[model samples]
Target: MAPSYLSIALIVLGEAFASQLPLFETSSLSQTHLTAKELISSKSLQDRIHVDNLLERANTLYSIAQLGEDEYNHPTRVIGSKGHLGTIDYIYSTIAQLGDYYTLSNQSFPAVVGNVFESRLVLGSEVPQSAIAMSLTPPTKKKQPVFGPLALVSNFGCDASDYLDLTSKIALISRGDCPFGTKSSLAGRAGAIAAVIYNNEKGALGGTLGTPSPDHIATFSISDSDAALYIKKLKDGEEVQASAYIDAIVESIETTNIIAQTKEGDPENCVMLGGHSDSVTEGPGINDDGSGSLTLLEVATQLVNYRVNNCVRFAWWAGEEEGLLGSDYYVSVLSPEENLKIRLFMDYDMLASPNFAYQVYNATNSLNPVGSEELRDLYTEFYTSKGLNFTYIPFDGRSDYDAFIKHGIPGGGIATGAEGVKTEKERQVFGGVAGDWYDPCYHQLCDDVGNVNLTAWELNTKLVAHSVATYARSFDGYPKRTGIEATAVLDVPLSKYHGPKLQV
Candidate 1:
């Protein structure tokens, strides 16, 4: 027989009490304060926010690894070996602090095969120099490589035909039509032992391994400037090889993923909220998502107090900086039933920084629904309701949500911005100065806490919470934002969701 509503309520209640109750140093509630007319006459709602103590605790918790000062994107100095591990560790700690309101787990995957490196290339000659190798890459076995120096040969903007004869040779090229994995596969197919990629442009490279290849080979990247120096030397016909090694054997070290939850009730109805906690070895990533990570923790902490229906989850993913490795692994492992149970995926990635504008990807191909006009309207409505202003954009269904979208989940999310400086047109839209970075710190060391615009940061977090709660409250059977109409929603066409195309 189906479990009775009372039975489910009892179980959820037990779980809620299972953890230490939220201390609610401040009453954990929504932005609406009833004292409105009386208080609004003088005070600001922002003033009522309990920032100091929360910031202290959050900083105390988030400060692990003294990450603010760390060079790696997501180091787990206090938890696991890599930055992703640190993310899982934090989720676990938060779960414990929140009294097991949720349980955190990890999903491990191997992408870049063959020899791995321990110390992430902090900045190979330049901040954007090191191309992110797939996790499947094995660790370099020796201090020095059998091959003395590697060559910097252009793949001709990722066209493999350029370097046809590279057997036993390592080639450095740039990104183009081919996926990184595809290029690597082609290089492998060409008998080339390995390949490295260099950027043609100045910004950070955001694409992941384009296609998945199982070749056990050494593959990575060096910046365009760094590659140029090598290229010049090679043009002069000088040997340009370098040794490579990493102790990446599974036995060498362990990896983990931490998760938390609002309350999993009935086990059938559940909602999820998550982000990759693990950072790259590139930069500190306070903005790449340290801000989002902090936001997730704060929202989870705030939501834990209010009683609700359905299971709501908070997951801090690892290895996201490593091409969404952790979250991908997590999604790949879910039972078909579990995957279906996740009605929505509200992903919070790099939202706090004023550097970038905001975008929401509504993926329909995967488990999630496609980007709909209604979803956009919901965001605008939520923002306006909270007295914040925002422009609704389309969905670019990338990121870990791909895992869910693939499983048929209705995925929608918020991102403050990435690279691509805000244009005058966008300035007219979002009201920021033109020529400013959409997310200047993107993958750089400058992605510190200071980069976050406090107002925007706080608003972004609140907006996410509002969206999640609205969905949960209205989730009688279907995933819908409360009081929102289908017609009112803005649908970012699939083409635009991935951003614009170049004009000839």
Candidate 2:
């Protein structure tokens, strides 16, 4: 059990000390409480899910992201950023209110965090277009830029041969097929002094290299239109040389994963749910994940009022935006015995895209674990019972569930959508723009509180409540977790992906 006194101490210290924590709120402690002895059910739990509570949480997260403006120059909650630390404290303090009802532990880990001080990209005498330095990339020297003739590489720069004959030149690569780190490394291997990646879609590009790569050269990302303009010039027999300068810093920073498990249930058979707590370096990520994070928070808060037959673990993962660092670390540290105790895992991400679709992960794929289909059915059934239309998303490993799924855990979740375009058929099912991106502000400076669609978010939050309550009551139809040795690893090259649809 967690040290119950810690919760008491935090409460007794008054709002002064807790207020010192970023975006701390005392208002949550006054919510309506239910009788602890009442049996938990789907209705009882879902009844407690309220839109007002979620909206308030969204406002708090937006406020937390704003706190970063003084330190990060933008509203952000990227790993190791001030806004992210505040998010951690806020979650910790909120869960701390449960006292010993939940066993809480802050799992600390080292992560590589990067920030762009400044970056500039110019295509031979043309006005400089907007660009952002890819995370974990080394910066160009002060006042010294990397310049050479521009050569658009064949394919997506996933292979070294694509950069042949491009020695000392700046390689222009498309965004797809592999990770940004792989592309940058391939460019460097071909003797390219610098590399530029353009978005496959019609927006400004923001990307990451996944991890530090010694072979990586200074890299920058530009929009698709900018790249098309330069591509046309080069194709029209015009010589295009590029000069790029990026001033950035990459360093190892300490961060933590917040894990809270119920103390009143069966520890050996646990039901786990999680969402990424940290956002991208862009805007306040209320929809990107703040929506999902608060879903878990609100559920866990109300969950304490009832008893459960199975232990429930609520994890607010850190460093997820930096390539699932926190969740991966969590899985790596668990012993085989400890891992088997987790019967199933559910992930919640992007529950509130402004242009939304009801999406549940497709568990029918042969790649999923034994019980995955059952988890999917639970969600589809809930939506069906409500006469709500939902679609199936591929198991692309784009979120924190990647680690658990990789290790053969039956995992499932819901998402409104990310940068992927919504289909006309989806428009017929769920009202939204068919040809537009689900969340246009995905990983951009506009994913603030306003980005969330409260209607969609509220409906998904109730689904989350239903899933938690059902599993907490009993894992009756759910398959029991088998020994680790019998589990087969999922055969997806998930590391190559950086977004919802794009490979890089």
Candidate 3:
């Protein structure tokens, strides 16, 4: 059982949590509410099943804690791709440490554009000394100031009409309703040499958000602090031009998805639990996903020894911070046949955002809900019994699950919340303060060690173990869960890939 407060929460769960508990669990089957205390002392399910040991292995948050920004953001996968090497090494030093039934797989896919627009910025004066990664093409020359070469987009918040009015200069704009990528790509299509996006928000643009620049266009996000001075000068009738250049050069660097298989007796279908291991160049994402990455690795270690009824594959995706590249590619590379073989998908993106609220992303009808409707329904029952108040967070299909769903695979997962926070309505439902940031550090440098909500992370970790263990133990026929909306046309294709129809 959880602490006293949690018990009260169960009671306060009132209608939804109370009535749904029994339906979520059965006597022949175990409930998903196994606490850390119970998990530590719980005996093996069968001679081959040991959930407690799995929890212990899944609790290696400290070792991942020791990983510096460099290691967390870098590639141990120097051979085939960049990212976690353990995923591909059928034999891993990490798995050897577990000394159990864990199989490392190359988990390799026909590499997609893992890295696009690797750039550097050094604004001499007009733009202060800062780092900016615009979705535009990289500059051929090193470190160009934001003047002379850049063109300013006047009256931004309005239509991009001003963009069409301008000639072949790098369009300078401010961030607003539209994404930087969208704006850059727009300018690029209009013959703009590149894009210089001055910050409209208060401080720095922080970290890379998404990859919108399809290809060939150069884009850069200038600091708002620095853009202020330029804007002030320009507004005051002082002409300010930036010397910016973008290199739209193409490169073929290998990127891989880490895959580790947990074998059981019968393996007609498989379940996937993963977190992207790649981090931004700006900082090591110990928390942006390090929290989740470490958590996923721990879960895999603990269960590597479990003997179960279904196949469970643990993955550590790369380039997620870089727009779900690793997960997207792995799924993109899979043949239609391979995709159909998947039973379900789970993502552990930000398991612990320091001072964050507990949240779960619900797969929707349009997203194919990541997995079969049956899985979503099962998860709903699982969370209900656990007394967890879950919000039906829309699936962005921006995680590894995106690829799986693209191929019609079933998917779902838990999240600790990100930049999106709870509104007054949300707070009312989940009990967190309204107006509080979901994760203040979100993707910034501050998302490092010592910045985590241990309780939230611990609970989520346990949730993963419970959900995964229960999933493995139950061998329901893959009759295809149903009842969510159909996949949306609004959903973008999984990858920016176009290869020989990838084989399963």
Candidate 4:
């Protein structure tokens, strides 16, 4: 005999009750005068949001690293790390305290996190220059320092023919035209013992192989000056002997995305906003994303004091540094009906670059979804009303919103800036050093709580709160949700989305 629906429901309810999971109950609203309609009126909720609250939360996130010795050395909230897991616990517990007002779930997913233990490049016994190991490059099993005669490859080394007769030599390639992975694979196939790729333009080279490849030998990148000197030495009939070493670990780890949605609103129409929860292995990443994550958390926490018309979902995504894995996984697993319920998606990332610019995602482009333009306009209007000048950055699917956009969901967000150098024109408009990077400590050990620009951080957080409040009040100006299968029409390479190439 099959079980009845009522009996199944009773069993599920019993399990939930036994587990002490808080379930949504509309009766709870009677205890407070802050009803959904009242909460949205006259920008009341926005006024309640304070920058102090956001900073306090950010400090709390930073303190998570101070809890124990393991995190003290790393001091990073990278996914699967102790600091990151601690961050997850904080968010989960914080949201769980809201009880019936919000429904919270931890979405689990698997991700492979890579960390470069040691990377070095020794050219002809000169002072060894620092070189970043390309992500996913296999460790050399032969010896600690693989020695070889340096040979230059032609045309970016994308083809096998470009690496002919390179047996037992270190193939030196330039950055351009193809991925670092392609060049590395071609070097390995041509019987080269190791590979060194230098930057074509100015500055240090930092990139990834996109994925792990067996054909990828140990590869590293140096500066353009270093490569130029080596090429010139080789052309002058000087043998350039190079030694390269890289030790790295790539491990599959399990992580969770903390998701919370308002229980008081219409679930059929939902507004989603999120930022990456994890940081790079270098530091605590307080500004890289701690600014954005805590902004969402602060906004979500304050929103619990009120109500909403349409559901607002807040997510703290993991594995974002590993190429948007968490957000991508979240969207990939959603059913068609679930996808359609999402009216719009907003991403908040890197909102506190030390040298900042108020940048909104460029949704006016042809590559955006049907309703993205309106979303962009809403942000523009919000900034304009405040007498702020903002610029439109390309929506190149680099951040967490990439997945949402690929699912046909209209997506937009704001960024202060990252490693991109601030130009003189931007300096005239935003009042910052012209040649300085937006965030000098991006993905570095210095990206701690002190790396934030409080002015930008506070302003960006308020903008987040405003957006949330506006959309939660009503989706009247936004287009109806479309269930059409999404394709990345503007699929620009990830390299184009960020500033200059920095460390991986």
Q: How many residue pairs clash in each candidate?
A: 56, 0, 30, 0
Stretches off by above 4 angstroms in model 4 are: 1-37, 67-72, 127-130, 165-167, 232-238, 491-504
lDDT by residue for model 2 over 220-325, one digit each (tens)? 8889987888888877878898888888888898788989898777899999999999998767899978999999999998987788888899999988887788
- Stretches of candidate 1 above 4 Å error? 1-54, 67-87, 100-163, 167-174, 188-253, 264-266, 362-374, 386-388, 392-394, 428-433, 476-504
Which of candidates 1 and 2 reaches a greater TM-score?
2
- Writing each residue's lDDT as its tens digit, candidate 3 over 1-504 gives 113322332232224321322211122212222211122211232233333433332333223222332443532222222222322221233543453355555444433232333454333244355545542244433434333344567666235575664445656677665555456566766666656676676665532324333533556666777777666665666655445644333334455565777534335567678877655443445566666766766666556444666677788776564456677777767665566556678777777665465555556544464344555665567568768766656555545666665556667777767767668877776665678777776655565555566666666676777767766766455455332233533133432211111000
The TM-scores of all predictions, comma-separated, are 0.66, 0.86, 0.66, 0.87
Name the top lDDT candidate. 2
RMSD of candidate 4 to the truth, in angstroms, is 7.1
lDDT to native, each model:
0.52, 0.81, 0.52, 0.77
Instruction: Give the Å shift of residue 452 in candidate 1.
Output: 2.0
Instruction: Tell me the RMSD of model 2 versus the true structure.
Output: 5.4
Ranking by lDDT: 2, 4, 3, 1
Candidate 2: clashing pairs of residues? none
Tens digits of per-residue lDDT for model 1, 165-186: 7766766666555555566666
Per-residue lDDT value at 41 in model 1: 9
Task: Compare candidates 1 and 4 on lDDT and give the better one.
Answer: 4
Top model by TM-score, which number?
Answer: 4
Where model 3 places Cα greater than 4 Å from the true spot, the runs are: 1-91, 108-132, 135-137, 149-168, 173-194, 198-218, 222-252, 366-373, 422-436, 475-504
TM-score for predicted model 1 compared with the true structure: 0.66
